[model samples]
Target: MLSTEDLALLEAIRETGSLSRAVAHLGKAPSTVSYAARQLEERFDALLFDRRRYRLQLTPAGELLVNEAARLMQDVARLTQRVRQVANGWESRLWIVTDELLEFETLIPVIDEFDALQSGVPLRITQEVLIGVWEALREGRADLVIGATNEPPAIANLRWMQLGEMQWVFAVSPRHPLAKAKGPITRAMVAQHRAIVVADSSRVTEGSTYGVAGGQTVLAVPSMRAKILAQCNALGVGWLPRHRVGLATRLVEGTDRFI
Candidate 1:
């Protein structure tokens, strides 16, 4: 409940150690400082100043008030700053959802840059596959979405821009039959093998799948990383992000036969 003026008056008196000196430090009349000092003692019903000593000093109770007041002042300052930040349209927290096709590691540098702003907004990152990315935003579960694949569905107040294009490669384990298949493998040939796919995480939507041939068996995994591992272990074969295929999985040549 202590006011800023009260704290300033106490600090000036404690620092200067005398009535006249305190008045000079506070840029106030000597009479005014003397009256404020007496008022403070009466308000607290305690002798806050030790005038018995030649060099005026604060009593133990006064010292405690000043120390605690400093901490309260800091809390007030932080609260005021947060209020202004909110008034200026800064979000209290941000939730970002990205498709599993985009590696989470790729966002580390961007996160570091956002941290430099010191906006005091907490960030949460999550991943979904295929339509689940857009579903997160539409369902009020995400503040922003990244690497969402396919055209965005209709959602009120939605804003979007194309981030970039992603290239895909039909990949399989070196040990798989497709690894040595003849040029221009047919959809019928792929249908003979199981396809590894990342399961969509949408709760309300029917969800979607990609790169699976008709009547092909499927190994639906939770993430793209799992699909890649499945292909590497010769568990199945399917299209993967071109950048993620790497040397562990062999890219099927002549994929132009059936995109």
Candidate 2:
């Protein structure tokens, strides 16, 4: 429970190594510094100065106190700064939920930029699919949501902006029948094959799916990446983000759409 003044007095005495020099360094009278030094030792019930030494050095106990107290002061300063930041509208901890359709790797640069700010707010990033992204924000499970898909639903105090649109391509494994389909793949034709889909993570709300026709057989997977893998392995066919399709899968022509 040492006060800042006590810490400063100890530091000055240690640094200067003489009562007269410590008083000069502290801009205090010699008698005042001497009396304060004696009070500090009495309060702690430990000899803090090596007065027997001609140079007036600090005892080991005094050195330990100064070093530990300086470290504690630094911790207090950091805690104070974080408290003020929270008071100024920064969240003490941030939980960000992104749609599983959005690759987590794409947000690395933005995360690095946030780290550079040294805001001291802890960040938690998670992923949800389809309606689950919106549900996370609505249910108070998330503080921020990134790359959420579909029209945003009504939620109290919700705020958002369009990051950008994603283009979708109907993709399938090269060995799949659709890869060699003769003409434009109609909704009827798509319905004939099992559609791979990432299941919505929503618990409270009725979740939704996209691009699947009525009565179509579905292979519900855990994430968009799994859906892509299922399609690439000829497990099923479905629309996928164009950027994620790559050469491993063939894109069904004439079905490009933006969302």
Candidate 3:
């Protein structure tokens, strides 16, 4: 049986189009890679390559093997990624807590991207309040945490990767009485309507660092789903990500109460 290293060299040589280049890439002297190839030629008892004046050309059998080896190389790459992820506690082992309200716009896309790129690295995510998400990560209850942040990041043990600017928008259910206007919503108008807002759990500070306006007081709801559910009742307005905006709520542009 050919050693795995032998198979790897075959694939690498095919990829780089030169035995010397493959040896250099693998940090092996040219002679070592050449010896491996010679061993394979002897085992098969057939000329796999036709040496030319200036370049090496694969014979028919050699070309066929290279094509088959390409498939094996892909499998090996994915396996290697899984092994690395497992070694680092990243494979089948990501725990995330985030606002359920941000599902459509931000959450789903982020989850999809990681899963696709990492392949076998499965992610286990939880939907929780902004504050609860922070607590989950901080208390070692979760692996990754995300929510609104106006100041510097605060998770001490876990590292945070910023995903660009997360923008907040105002959404009122389509069934609301004032759903038909182009003018900006005043804070006073929002107070007159029922309002839904996400509250942090034990880890979050009670007041807004982003600040709220329009005389609209926020009713702190626990998780993202709960906030959306409450807002879905058509009795109130709430904050939502633009990526997740839906038919139930129309975004109130300016002068809308948001935090």
Candidate 4:
């Protein structure tokens, strides 16, 4: 129930060493500070200050209130700033969907910078694969999309910027037949092996996949990690991000398809 003025009185008295000095520091009359302090103490039925002390001294209850008041003031300040930012037309919240193929570690640094700005906009992030990234924006589930691949589906008012081209490496387990093939593997040869693919996360669109050869059998998984596991286990063969699976003889180079 103590007001900011009462808390400021405690703080000023603590810092300035006496009631008269606190009044001078606060630019208030000595009587005003004294009367407010007395009213606060009477309301709480606790002595806030040891008035007999030569210098300003707080009773245990006064110290507790001061400590708590400091924290409360910080919360109040942050809330006030957020309210002002919202009133100034800043976004209250933003949602983003990133493609599973994008390296999440690279995004962390940007997120750290955004947090430092304290823009009063809450950011929520989620992962989608391929076309699902675009669908999230179209469906109004997200305000931003990162690492969208292919020409985004023809939706009106969709604006995009290319972050950079993502390179995919065709890979398979050491045991897979493609790993043993010496010459350039054609689309027909690739079709003979089962392709491991991460399923798109779209709810509204039909969703899409890339790099799978015509008529290739597929082992669909939920995430990029799952696709890697399937290839390592010889469950399927498909392209994966080069950084994730690493360079190996089982991985074919020069198959860099830009996405």
TM-score of each predicted structure versus truth: 0.69, 0.72, 0.45, 0.76
- Where in model 1 is the C-alpha error above 4 Å? 1-78, 247-259
Candidate 2 residue runs with Cα over 4 Å from true position = 1-71, 247-259
Error of 1 at 106 (Å): 2.2
Highest-TM-score candidate: 4
Q: Model 3: how large is the Cα RMSD against the reference?
A: 10.1
Best by lDDT: 2
- Global lDDT scores for all candidate models: 0.82, 0.83, 0.66, 0.80
- Give the clashing residue pairs of candidate 4, or none: none
Whole-model alpha-carbon lDDT for candidate 4: 0.80
> Which digits, one per residue and each the tens of the lDDT, describe model 4 over residues 1-259?
8677877877777677788899998999878888998898899898888888778788999888777877777777777888899899877688989888776787999999999997867899998887778888888888888888877887788888777776678888877888789999888888998989999887876677778888888888998877876787779888877777663333434244222
Task: Name the weakest run of 10 consecutive residues (lDDT summed) in model 1.
Answer: 250-259
Q: Please give the lDDT score for candidate 1.
A: 0.82
The pairs that clash in candidate 3 are: 105-243, 105-244, 131-200, 187-214
Residue-by-residue lDDT tens digits, candidate 3, 31-123: 888888988899889887777744667889998877877777777777888888778765456776665544535577776777577467666
| Candidate order, TM-score descending | 4, 2, 1, 3
Ranking by lDDT: 2, 1, 4, 3
Candidate 2 residue pairs that clash: none
| Residue 68, model 2, lDDT | 78
